[model samples]
Target: MTGLIKKYIVYTAVLIGLLVFLHAIGALRPAEQYLSRGLNPLLATIYSWGTNINVAFDEQTGKADLWQQINDLQAETNQLISKNAELKAVEEENAILREYLNFFNDHSYEHILSRVISRGDITNVIGRTESILIDKGSTDGLRIGLAVVDEQGIVVGKVAAVKEASSLVRLVNNQQCKLAAGILGSEATNGITEGELGLTIKMNFIFQEVEIKKDDIVITSGLEETIPRGLVIGKVSDVNKENNELWQSAHLIPLMNTNNLLIVSIIKP
Candidate 1:
């Protein structure tokens, strides 16, 4: 097989050499030129097809690049939206802090600001938040029975338990919470306002002859240690006469909803 391949290669070389010799004498030169000229159009067509393939490849690459740019822009837009929401929340909280600072200034009270961290809910008693946790605690000069108020000087609760870094505030409507309160216009009819059913403030043991009316404002009487007077508690929502012939009671709606209290001030002793 090797000998046969070598013989064929020798024959091919001899044929090419004979052809070159004929062309040199001007015998096949004209025919060779004619053949080359005839192939020029086909060569040009092949070159054009290669150029089209290159253009198509470039166009595909450009489309891929364009899609990548669009995805990058979408991700940036989402980041900006999240950043804007955070800024708006910060602005609103700053406004709340400023209002509280000014209120304490005018009222001439020493106080510390605290942020509410969490809330307490009784699953058995739906829709009631009995207490909340604040960021400030015993380390921040917080202790039990210290009155806590919202930005507008509305009493919301008192510090019930304290830890090194946090404290629990029993809301004004918690049954365990009681305040020495006075009717806005009836100082002589001062009574203790106790939270009833984790829902409303019920001032009990009022004499039946006190002549109390609905919508009367109740406030702290300054009778308890560390609690200031004139802090708004709520308005009388309903009045009830006692079954025990000697006493009467009324329901008071809290001035602020505990569910919305995110910041508060602890009145210093």
Candidate 2:
């Protein structure tokens, strides 16, 4: 133990002598500058690594925020589209109701409003007679032979069959439907109008010299017990006359389209 203590004291004395010699020659200052230069690159590399780590973290956070905003905007756009569709449907329904109300106010006839429910059997014999099923029947005072009119008060069809809560309407273009009609003019020529092959109406038995012309408005003559006068059937599209025949005929086109029927009124006398 005593020998080891002596060796340590000699080593300390030697390091003190060496430091004193290096300081006298200005060697300590040069060594300090060299050491600083060598360590500079290491310190700079550590600082750059720290800065890069921080920037990468910030970029990741920004990307996450941007994605969240895009999702929020997409949800808002879908909600707006659904609301717009609902509003459009409501507007169309209101327009249909308004048209029905106007038809009620324009005429003094007693009528029952009915909706077309379904189409009945289509007999394609001469042409195509389209029959529609309505939501009114004997329960709603609807019966066979009741004149049905469109929203504009133009004659559309007549009730052919009725049930407890439903009725079948034979359209004006049906071959079985016939109306006593007359031209609306000074020399009002009258004739029997019947559906030709369920396509168009033909006014037969008009006197050749009765002064009928094309585009003349035709109306009911009120000769039938069920139909009323002045109900428009159609307009005269063509006047057909044979040179040897004593009578002339007029092809009539219905004012209302039967295929597009939605709501109709049954004229209740």
Q: Against the true structure, whose TM-score is highest?
A: 1
Each model's backbone clash number: 0, 0
Native-vs-model 1 lDDT?
0.73
Over 4 Å off in model 2, which ranges? 1-107, 123-129, 186-189
The superposed Cα distance between candidate 2 and the true structure at residue 37, in angstroms, equals 99
Error of 2 at 209 (Å): 3.1
**What's model 2's overall lDDT?**
0.71
**Model 2 agreement with the true structure over 1-269: per-residue lDDT tens digits:** 99999999999999999999997786785665455445535544554465456545655776967855764674464344323333443454456769777533233679999877665576575325467777666767888887888866677888999765667898877777778877653324389887887788888999877777887777776677887666677878999988799899999987665544667899887
**Model 1: per-residue Cα lDDT at residue 76:** 66
Q: Residues 93-128, candidate 1, lDDT per residue (tens digit)? A: 457769777543233579999776666767746768
- Who wins the lDDT comparison? 1
